[model samples]
Target chain A: MRLSVFHPVSSLIYFAAVLIATMFCFSPAIQICSVVGALLELFMLESKREFFRNLRFTVVVWLAVAVTNPLFSHKGVTPLFFINGRAFTLEALLYGVMLGGSLSAVIMWFKVFSKVFDRERLLYIFGRKTPKLALIITMTRGFVPKLKAQYRRICDGRKCSGTYMSESRIERLKASCGIFTALCSSTLESAVQTGMSMKARGFGTGKRSFAHSFKFRFGDGVFLFVCILLFSAAMIYSGTGKLRADFYPRIAVSSEPLPMLCFAVLCAIPFILEVKESLKWKFCLAKI
Target chain B: MSKKTFSNLIFLLLIPLLCVAGLLFFRDKLYAWLSVGITVLCCAGYFLHFEGKEIKSAQLAIISAMTALSVFGRMCFAFLPGFKPCTALVIITGMYFGRESGFMTGAMTALISNFYFGQGAWTPFQMLVWGLTGYAAGMLAERLKKSRPTLLIFGAVSGPAFSLIMDLWSCIWADNGFVPPRCRKFFVRLYRNDAGILVSFKEFLCKITENWQVRRAQSR
Candidate 1:
């Protein structure tokens, strides 16, 4: 199994630590480390084509954030140029790029996060904490595809009946609205039926027991421990003015090397694990 | 009035004050706290309002179904730029079922859909905006039920409202402080596209009402 598919708790802790570090740490070095780590992890877990598709999204977000920041924010002393009467500062521009990079890094991490923690994992974690909420999430997940199918069926039916042949904007709007109203009513009606069936099955009567396929092993425990230790160490360094950056008056970042190294190690944890796992798998396959 | 109604009234009254406080005092440092605070307050009010009455499984299912429908509706119309029925569905839900249900549906829809769209700092703001639209629709449910034109107007207004609230987050994040001129520019650019969706949605609602009336007349 992949390293990220470890026990749910381990997976959550690792992702949460990396995401928090990525979001809170303002140092450009740490941000770049996170972006690289996330990209490497994605490449390891997903296909090359998938990685490129995801990269497109991150690049767009990064560019937008980078370009817009300097226009709205005129902070810092080093003026690059005057843009439409507003002073565009070098610090602000650099800060914008850093912000965009961090934002993209966060987005990439979440992409990995969503892949690891699918609906089943989320339900496993949240079921005991809040059963009703978990049930609602499950129901919502189930309903999305069903609703899409229903919409297609409705559209096809309308087309067959010559009702969907509308060239005017108003006629198209009416047809779309008609389709939705039908969908809304039918879904609600079916929901009531489903609710009745669930009630009859003794739902919401008492404490519910969920069957989970995840097993916590000694390796998972050790993995959690190492993640927690590294995450806390990185956070402590961040708190002690080691990861500080000032972008307002001028661009300044801490010259400390130890904290940056610690952050780099923390961000690289996932990529390292994935590489190790794949190497082990390859060695075993060669022996076989 | 019952204690719950009185408390809800007070909560409604405090929303404006909260907005003003976030704008005037807590723009830089406490902005996240303020956004989280508003979300928590709205959710707390929802739960409190529904306390003691076992919100039946049917009710939960309906909320889930409606939220799913809205999210799917958004996905289906992805080819159409900015034309989504998310707000219209929320309005209809609020009109039929009470305010709390409306709020729950809107907030949950935003949460679940963000799983696909990629969650960010802006998710909470989107939830708050959609939730408030549903809540306001519920508040004026009586009037909206009586008049289709009023419902259309409300739907139109809500489209812009959702866009404006979303832009507020971008404004705060981009500027790091509230700058009126920049905000106005951003709002205009963003709302211009969103306004098309709202107008289309309004027209859709009007068409639906007219068809319903005609069908009723024929049946009678």
Candidate 2:
């Protein structure tokens, strides 16, 4: 199994830490590291085609933002050139590039998030906090397809009666609306029965219990601990003014290796895990 | 002078004031963070508010059903891009059930339909805007029900409201044109007004639950 199987909250915490660090910190070093980390991680989890597709998009957005930043912003002292007597500054270009980098980082992270985080994981997270809301959401999600099926049935019946043979587009919309109305009423009617059934079964009477599917193993705990430590260290290290994320008046920064190393390790944690897991699998296959 | 006055001033005046100050200090650098924070907080607050309610199983089922209906409407009308009955259904749910329920239906409709469409950075914003529209419809339910013109006007206006919120977001992120006056006024007023709207939100919830408890007591 991939690192995604390592307790849902562990992955969630790791993702949250990365997001917070990337989001709040505007340093080029971290942003570049993030871009590399994201791309490599995407390559590890997803196919080569998926990796290239994301890379192509990220590069385009990064360049476009970088190029456009100089046009819109005339801040900073160093001007590469002038357009309409407005100074096109190097600092703005760098700032724009970083901005684009961070934006692309966000998109890539979310892409990775979508891959790791499926609907079940989403439900799991919400389910812990607000079971009722999660239940409602689940019911609603399940209900839509059922409603659609009913809508199809209604349309089929309508079609048989020559209702859809309307000569005009407007009439077709009208026919669809009529079907929708029928669907709505029928669903609402069934909703009452569903409610009655739920009432009889005694939902929301007291505290609810669940059969545990996800066990927090020792590895998960260690993973969580390492993530929090690195996140806080990076945050505090940056807070102490050892490293800065400043751009556009001047690209002000100081390179401190420790925090940067911390971030790299944090980002590489999953890549490391995936590699280890794959190697173990290969060894087992060789033995067989 | 009064306690309520001070509270209103804090929420209505001070929060927006602090937001502007933060905007000035950070400049455009933190727009991404700001948007993320806003989206997460708004959705979290909505869900938390939902959890703190006393809802019956029957009510929950109806809410799910209504939410399903709106999403289904959106899917059915996918052939015609601009002509989804999702908004209409949301408004109707709000008008009939109440604002919070309307908000739930609207928010969930956006949330669920996007699963079929595609989830993006814009999903939370869409949820917020649609939910707010349903909420406004709920708040103005009686007036809307009585007056056909008012309902029509609301239908007319809500389309722009969604677009406006989205435009403000895009303008902040993508538009390299640094700082228009209109944008400034809008940003300030929007923060101020939305914060201000929270007071009315509190009042509306109180009115709803108070009536609910009283009606329950009467029946008992």
Candidate 3:
């Protein structure tokens, strides 16, 4: 499914629920589920090349987190080895793996979120909540790219004028500083112009209305309901100790498997939706 | 004192006291939660305080512009390793504008730039550090504006302060508790790179200030 096609509110709810659930749920089973679900969702949503490219970074991060946690946190009973008089335990290693998995899952979910929530949708959501803050966000969003273009122009102009050429470190530094100052002044000047134009346009005088392209539909409602249900169920399961795991003194998992299965299904909802949508599209193409 | 100033004073005082209390009394997870909680409270307090004031479009425009410049500046210097003008720009913003604007700019820069850099738990901590740096500059604006040397010193000092705050977050995250000795290693590593950048930043500010002065003289 094109998650971005959903109403902003529905997408927001889904992401918020999944991301928070992944972060808060520390059990190995839940963490693994989250990681797998996130990876599948990313693969389905992103192009294969893009998915692999992102996967490399996530793997590096996962390895780093997994490695470092075991090194720093030397808790648990089963001593795997002794390094520099510090004991590396099996439980700590497992804990680190879980932490790494959960972290990567969270990161992947955010990547998907960024794809879905483009600048306009973000502005729409924030504008509804706080207009002034939304205006600032919008301005900054527009300003960064403009400033980058300006910086490049400044650099090119300076290079041509030989103002940037200097052998001495201090001279080079001062020249760059001159460029930076010029940039700042120009930026400030343009900001003043923007402010004046906004004032003329009756900005900050009254409540502002935003033109929204998307509206709440039945599909959005259903998506939002599913998200809420999954989130609440996960929370309830976690709260009742059905999803408990301890890795400090010793590694232990909860004997009850029903709640863990439910949690996995909850996490898999997004991936399932995407797969179902893709299959439907494929079938329609075949029929044609 | 007026009620608003009184509350502001109380908030200003309460923050440090709470920090000390959190450090001395709470450790590990509780301290982590407390730090996060305090940051949220301070951000909320600043927002509410700003809401009470009359914010002109000019102020908002300037803040947005400055924040964009700061983020871009950070990107420009990304290759230099620890030599970003974000803190300097934030300080400059605070020196010119009020504290709230500075804080907003700093906080927003952290939030927005992370869209490029990727966000995690560290984002909030970064926001707190940069926001407080801007807030500090705003608080000391009067003294800093008096002399170029003072501004330079503040710029240099803020670099270490920024690194120290970031190091504290890492220390908290890594050890799950603050150990002074463990934190020292991280500080030493950061200080080596950060100090050079900060000193250069001071010189950079000096150059900018000189240019501004010359412009003013010519205009007059």
Candidate 3 residue-wise lDDT, B38-144, digit = tens: 67666655655565567889899999999998888777666557777888888878887878888889988888888887876567778878888889989999998
Worst 10 residues of 1 chain A by lDDT: A126-135
Model 1 lDDT, residue B168, Cα: 78
Instruction: Give one digit per residue, the lDDT tens place, for model 2 in A1-288.
Output: 466887889999999888766655757777877878888789898888878887898899889888977776678989999999989899988888887887788778877887897767777887977887788788998898898789889989988987664767767766776676677668877998999999899887867876548888998898889899988887677666655666658878775999888888887777887888889999999999
Which of the CAPRI classes, incorrect, acceptable, medium or high, describes model 2? Answer: acceptable
Q: For each candidate, how many residue pairs have backbone atoms clashing (under 3 Å)? A: 0, 0, 0
Query: Comparing 2 and 3 by TM-score, which wins?
Result: 3
Lowest lDDT 10-residue stretch of candidate 2 chain B: B196-205
Query: What TM-score does chain A reach in every model?
Result: 0.94, 0.82, 0.91
Q: Give the poorly placed runs of model 2, Cα more than 4 Å off.
A: A47-71, A76-91, A147-189, A252-255, B1-39, B69-86, B110-126, B170-178, B181-220
Candidate 3's C-alpha runs over 4 A off are A163-178, B1-38, B41-45, B48-52, B174-176, B179-185, B216-220
Q: What DockQ does predicted model 1 obtain?
A: 0.35
TM-score head-to-head 1 vs 3, winner: 3
* Per-model DockQ: 0.35, 0.32, 0.35
Q: What is the TM-score of each candidate's chain B when compared with the real chain B?
A: 0.76, 0.66, 0.81
How close to the true structure is residue B48 of candidate 1, measured as C-alpha lDDT? Answer: 47
**What C-alpha lDDT do the candidate models reach, one value each?**
0.77, 0.74, 0.77
